[model samples]
Target: MEPVARAFAHVANMLFPRGCVGCDRPDAVLCPECHALFNGCLAQTLGTAEMGRWFACGWYRGAVRQAILSWKDHGDEECDRPFSEVLCSLAEQAGLPDHLGNVSREQVLIVPAPSSLASMRQRGRRHMMPLATGLASYLCARTGMHVRACEALENRGTAGRSVETGGTVQRSQRLKGRITTRGKILLKNKAVILVDDIVTSGTTMRRCVDVLSSQGAEVVTVLSLAHTPAGKPTKAGRHFSSEI
Candidate 1:
């Protein structure tokens, strides 16, 4: 059965060559042009009222958006390499905060945002773990930081919500009682970096920081692939437009 399946898969690929994950052009998972277009960072501030400084690679638009959606919705595991490359590039370009800069290899850890069991079941695998692993590997290779993705946070049976409908305050309130930290082993004195795929209103990231900080983890910073920038104010009051 395995051999038969492999043969079928080969035949399918031959019939329709793998295309660029971003633009669907033939020959590569992500072509050079798309990569170049997705390489720059967007203008946004790190919402550090609850946690440390946050950094994201680029805006959630164009090729970047398509690439992320492909991996997340279409199971394009091949997107990991390019995605991880961009992640490392972003990390290097945007240096870690001064507080996190002093932590040694043994003192540092990476904790990715926990995905829900229901979402895991639907996806048939844990997606964030691979991205986390790739990022950890890159970090270790570059900075010699002993990186580990701690399963310190849990979803606590909460349903995922869309970030577009409500405003930031309402979204923060929605996630108020959803997440919780696991284990009594406090990361109090340790340097920690939270990893996630994207950030919109930053409500979710703030919630994670609240949980980790309560557990004594010195949550130094956040690393994400894409971010939606805060919009400009209108004549009436502060306004928002979701361009990314």
Candidate 2:
């Protein structure tokens, strides 16, 4: 049934192409105007020494937020390519690839932050995986580095509650011991860059960093599609904002 629906959607798109996800402009996935919204290259940092820096392509507001929500929550898979490009561009602009060495036996991995089992079941896919793979490919081409996407993280379901709808401290506590490496991750002494669609409170990203660091992986930084501006966390911010 899902496959049939997807096939129908593909056929319909071919016959009557949809408009930009960000602006509803005709004949484009993401029009230049809306794409511009994702070009800000915003950098955020977590105060925790163990938690590495974080970067986002845009503020989680206005058209950028809309586009992200459409892609992430609503299954507008068409935006994946554009979002991947944005993240890769942000990486390049941040001087990430320049700092990387040439291809080595140990790959510099792009690791996607794990979605909760519930979220995965609801979305029917690990949405961040594509972005991670795409970014890895881009880095391989740009830096001649042995980079690849590693689904190294998995969420080990919370107890009788959701991680959402909590204060920053509360969320951090809840996420503790919730994320674990997927398998025998060979991350010892390897470099990693964590990827996610959105980050707020920095709790999720920090927890991810903690798990990777525990495995002797040097996480260079965290990257996301967009983040909320600094201030009180609005409902929107809590929904999809990166943390510093």
Candidate 3:
């Protein structure tokens, strides 16, 4: 019965394509204007990361946030293409191609930031896997390097609660020691590119970096679809406006 329903649902979607994730305009995953929202390369500093920074495609607000929420929580798988394109463009803007060395011999690993098991269960998938896989393929084609997406990180489900709504300290504490590497990954001396959907306060990204660094993995840089806007420009000294 489930398969029958899915088949009919698939046919129905073919006949009546859904609206864009950003604007709800008909028959598109992300209409041109909505896709445009994610066009810029915004870099933010992560004090603990290997490179001392990371990059995001855009700020997490307005249409960009709306589109991401739809795709991530509401299961709009169609947005994968446009979002993947965003990351690829970001890679170019961030000079990742040149940074990837010895194209023929180096096999870089694209690892998605871990999603808690509970979130995976709720979403029925590891949402970031598609973006990571897409980035891997793009890098391979563009640089002629062997890029593979590796799920070497996993969240042991300790953060299935209301972690997202918590304050910085609360969020950081909940995530501490919860992110662990998967079984027997030979990450020593490997080049890893960490990908995440959204980054706020850099807690999770920092932890992932710590784990990867512990294994002697050189994380080239971190990339995200979007990141929460920096706070208090006068104080934090790094507030990025929500604009492009």
The clash count of every prediction, one per candidate, is 1, 6, 0
Whole-model lDDT, candidate 2?
A: 0.77
Worst 10 residues of 2 by lDDT: 233-242
Task: Give per-residue lDDT, candidate 2, residue 193.
Answer: 90
Model 1 Cα lDDT, one tens digit per residue, 25-92:
99998899887754654333445422334667767777778888888755667777888777766666
Clashing pairs in model 2?
45-244, 46-244, 199-241, 199-242, 227-242, 228-241
For residue 91, model 2's alpha carbon misses the true position, in angstroms, by: 0.4
lDDT of candidate model 1 versus the reference: 0.67
TM per prediction = 0.80, 0.87, 0.87
Error of 2 at 86 (Å): 0.4
Distance from true location, Cα of 217 in model 2, Å: 0.3
Per-residue alpha-carbon lDDT of candidate 3 for residues 1-244, written as tens digits (9 for 90 to 100): 1355557757878899878888889988889998887877777666655455688888788889899999888776777888999999888887788878543334689999999897887777788988999999999898877799999999985545332657767777888788999999888877889999998877788889889889878888899998886474222333243321
For residues 1-244, what per-residue lDDT tens digits would candidate 2 score against the true structure?
1577678878988999898888889998899999988876666655542233567787778788778877877777888899999999888866678677532436788999888888777777788888999999999998877889999999986432222456777877777788999878788878889998877667788888889888888788888887755475333321332344
lDDT of each: 0.67, 0.77, 0.80
Write the candidate numbers in order of decreasing lDDT: 3, 2, 1
Q: At residue 78, what lDDT does model 1 achieve?
A: 72
